[model samples]
Target: MGEHCDDEQVVVKKLVNKRYLLFKIDLFVLSFVCLQYWINYVDRVGFVNAYISGMKEDLQFKNNDINVANTCFTVGYILGMIPNNLILLVAPPRVWLSFCTFAWGLLTLGMFKVTSFEQCCAIRFFQALFESCTFSGTHLILGSWYKESELPIRSAIFTSSGLIGSMFSGFMQVAIHDSLNGVRGLEGWRWLFIIDFSITMPIALYGFLFFPGVPEHSSGKSRFSMTKYFFSEQELQYARRRLPARDESTRLDWSVVPRVLKRWHWWFFSFVWVLGGENLSLASNSTFALWLKDQQYSLSHRNNFPSGIFAVGVVSTMLSAVYLYKVARSRHWHVATFIAVIMCIVAIMIRANPIKPSVMFTAQYLGGVAYAGQAVFFAWANIVCHDDLQERAIVLASMNMFSGAVNAWWSILFFAATTVPHFEKGSYALLATSISSGLVSVWIRKLQNRDSSRKQKLSYIDANDMLDEDDDDDDDDDEYDDQIAQNHS
Candidate 1:
């Protein structure tokens, strides 16, 4: 009875410790991660939000100009993904991310001065260079702090924060257009930049102050100075024990090339996101906003209507995250993949048939459910690459980098703004992408499952071999004892 009680006490203590550490992480780390990602989206998506708001008219953009500008951002965005994430290995996120945020905020402010399309593209390119780290960088940080089982929801929350930013961007644009249009002899679209800068600087400032670098290699001093003491020494030990061993280093070596190439993770996860990003071609296409615009809806209607899609994205992202964490638990990533595929079909049907605008709008909103795959796949990659921190960082960065690289051209070919409203070609292309995404996800999951099974089998065989050796030694001992007894006789 005493032994059982002791075991129970140990279990309870560990549970309490987990909760306590989680409290610290949520307060000090995830707050900045989520908020910065929020600000990141608001700024990154601000142009599209504003394009529909008034920038298109203000700049006299011809056909396909919005997409051309977006492509510039995508190109510039992917350029630094690998390099910047690599920087996180040598530099603390507090320093690296903070500086990037401040620079990006400055660039956002620069958007306030652009009067032409060329100028807009130039500023956006630089902004993308600065903002590239936000997505993959935060995923790496979240993976660093949270355990595997705990990651789905946290990852979901992180991804959802961006959609929340997007949701905010839509509503804020409407508000800005309503109240701030011509307030300072500037269009409301321009004010989006000003407000974005205001929001971004504060998030950047918070990150500078409180962003605990990586949990494993935290600085003795955060800008907050007290963050290091948040976890008890014992609790910190348990936290580190929960995660895989990570080597801390600043070395950049060519050996990283072959190491990354040898892993299925780099090639597969990165490719998976290319499909995932394409699976989301409909939302990225901004079809609902275009349909509203094509129907000559008011700027408020266009901006406000698309907000529903982002709203659905936010809810679906969280729900999927919770489902994965509590129920599906990642043995069923295919379920999420198929959900994405279904969303693509819905988009295709809406585009193909002469559906009512309301029905089409419903289809588009439902399509936002596909965005959940972002949380799903990214968290899966985090799990797969958890053993090596550098690989984790590289795979995470390359996933987004490769996706954005494909999307630069992918958008032009399939989702061009010039092809707005109907977007027949893009719809079919999106459907094709769904097939690819589902197939890849299924195959990858199967391979991972096989590998896990193989490892277990090897471990079992090794254990049995040891047991057999022990039995043989026991027989030898028995024979020797008998010999001695006979001699005494």
Candidate 2:
């Protein structure tokens, strides 16, 4: 008895240590994912800082040229998404994702040597091409490890990386502008690229070793490994009923592309993101700061102003995720779009307000709140498409790719140089896109409700049929077995 008790104690201690180690592994992976996303955004948007610094003069860029370069980068970004997602299906995410990080980091460093408008556009386009894999791929991996109940918070945490990156880029740029403008005869913008690239290297290396790939294949353990603590064979069966099945014979087939192409969910969510991305342009592009400067806001104020938008965004997103999860309802559409429409109106009002800096600042922060729906919409897509892993991954990438493609020409055409300060065309597009997205959200909810009802009816019929078949088999087996038993006796 004493020996048995000692053995039991040792086993419990080992189990406890395993659980602790697993949690640490998950925490490390989450932090690494967040950092990768942060660096990706910083590299992508560092150009905004470079542009505001001495880049435009050095490259002799016209405002049209600047818009064109952003468009180029976006085009490459759009082109890369679908292919990268397909690769994710076959390849371990850690390998592809790490290689992508290293490639983009090199591309960002390459930006320091770019001398002309054409060279800047070229480097940015390829950098975006390589950088495109991180966000959607990371989100897909998040979905693999987490359930629907855990998703919104993870998404909120993931998206906060971008906001933090945006905010940090501004501060870093300001610091570089102040301290490194003439360091080593290279401009501060050059230093921005060098520093940003350097930061990405270590992060890429860390991720390569640590990120858990897919759920069943994860080399590192996670919080969910606690299943070993409480689950027995009976409990495992009950849990398996709720979990999705794995198809052992499944191949990496691309023929499913046409079926995916026909899904209305993919298109509607894509449209949702395009609208979400319009709000992003207000922050993503340096357009807002340029517009503010044109309206005579001082350089220092311009630099400090946009950071508040992201700060508000971080708070709004976290709260929104919590609320949506608690309520467990699909009313996110109305909440998100209504705020977006309000932001556009406020922006228009600010543009019309010829005198007050304070009003415009308030409007921009409100706009950021409106824009928090980007996270909601993507999370919404995940929920809607959770039944099929293939479709879910494809739809997520499609949403982002379609949005990037639209924004490429969308930015250049409606938000060109001559259109700045007012951007009459872009403002109207925002209003229209907001309305369109809202209308589609209602339709998607209807479809989901219909699907739920259909599934219930099918399940009922299947259960009834199964009962009838069991009754028939039991009657036949008993009668034949009784005759056979009497003959044998």
Candidate 3:
């Protein structure tokens, strides 16, 4: 009875500890990353908001200037993605992420002072260099702490927060332009930057003080022992042990390059996201706003109407996450295929050049479904590459890096600012990329199935070999026993 009671107590205590650990992680780690990413999008889209509001007139901007600034930002974002993700291997994420957050916040604040398109492009480039850390970095940290079952929803939540930030930026810009414009001799657009900086700095400090680094490196003895206050020693040990076993021997040195390049993971997943990133061009390029501006809508309507697209994105992303977690169970390819089909229809609708606002609105909102790919594909990559820490980090970074590189040109070529209201070429491009992404997703599923089968076969062979050895030992023991009996007789 005592032993039974003790065993029950142990089980109950473990259950309690797990719940507590999850609560702390969700509160400190998940919340901080979401907020950081939220602000990242807010700052990123602030320029476009400013452009549509007054920056274009103030800076004497031309049609392609927005694309030029975006391309420069993409260039910086691409340059930083791989290197920044690699840095997380050696430096603590708490320090590195927070410092990057702070650096970009300052740059965002500096945006208010820009006097020329040239200056705007220069500032956006540097801002993107620092801002590049949040997306893939947070995915890496989430993979470190959460189980496969727990990851999809959290990733969805993290992603939806950015869309929410985008939605908020539109409304916030409208509000700032209404209230703060011409106050203290600063344009309403300039105040947007100042306000974004204010919202950003507190989150940076929060990350510095409370964000736990990865489980493998989160010892209380480290200089950034802040994680110690948030997690007990036992809980920290649980955090590490609960994750899937990884090759602890793997380091982020030059050897990782060959190891990564030799694998199908790097090539296929990177290509997957390259297509996935282009799939996002319709919403990410602010095409809806451009369409509204071309239609001669009021400034408020220009900002507010585009937000509906982001609203649809938030809904689609959460639904995909829930479906993946509860029903699909890591078959994220299903969601990818569905998104491609929906986007194809959306592209066709817009390409028809409908005269009604209702048709355009429907097409634009449906394109938001493409954002679901962000959560689905990245979660899939994290699960597939869970065994190798360095490979996982590199793969995630490479996926985003290569996508950003392609997007730098793809945006300028296909979705340029000049191709507003109709964007016939851009619409056709979206159709092609969406179909390609779906096809690649199927290919990834086939490869994953092959790898799983191979692993199963190897496991079965090892088990049979062990059984043979045991049988031989038993036979030898019986023979020896018989020999002893004969001697006694």
Candidate closest to the true structure, highest lDDT: 3
Error of 3 at 318 (Å): 0.8
Candidate 2's residue-wise lDDT over 1-489, tens digit each? Answer: 999999976543331122333354357556778999999988877887788677888989885888899889999989999888888887767778888999999999999999899998899889888888977777777766554555677788888888888888878888887898898999988999999999999988877766656545543333423323333332223222323333335345765676567767787788778877776665566666777767866645566677788888888888877875555343566556665666667557555652466665666677677546766887778766655667777888888898888888888877776776666676667667666666776777777666656652212121112222233433453343334322211
lDDT for each residue of candidate 1 in 324-352, tens digit (9 for 90 to 100): 65552235465557665676667567766
Give stretches of model 3 more than 4 Å off. 1-16, 222-225, 328-330, 456-489
In candidate 2, how many Å is residue 134 off?
Answer: 1.7
- For candidate 3, the TM-score is 0.90
The lowest-lDDT stretch of 10 consecutive residues in candidate 1 is: 457-466
Clashing pairs in 2: none
TM-score of model 1 (CA atoms): 0.87
RMSD of each: 10.8, 10.9, 10.3
TM-score head-to-head 1 vs 2, winner: 1
Off by over 4 Å in 2: 1-26, 220-251, 296-298, 328-330, 354-356, 456-489
- Report the lDDT tens digits of candidate 3 across residue range 323-396: 86556333788899999999899889988964568889999999999999899899989988887898999999
Q: What TM-scores do the predictions have?
A: 0.87, 0.82, 0.90
> Model 1 Cα RMSD, Å?
10.8
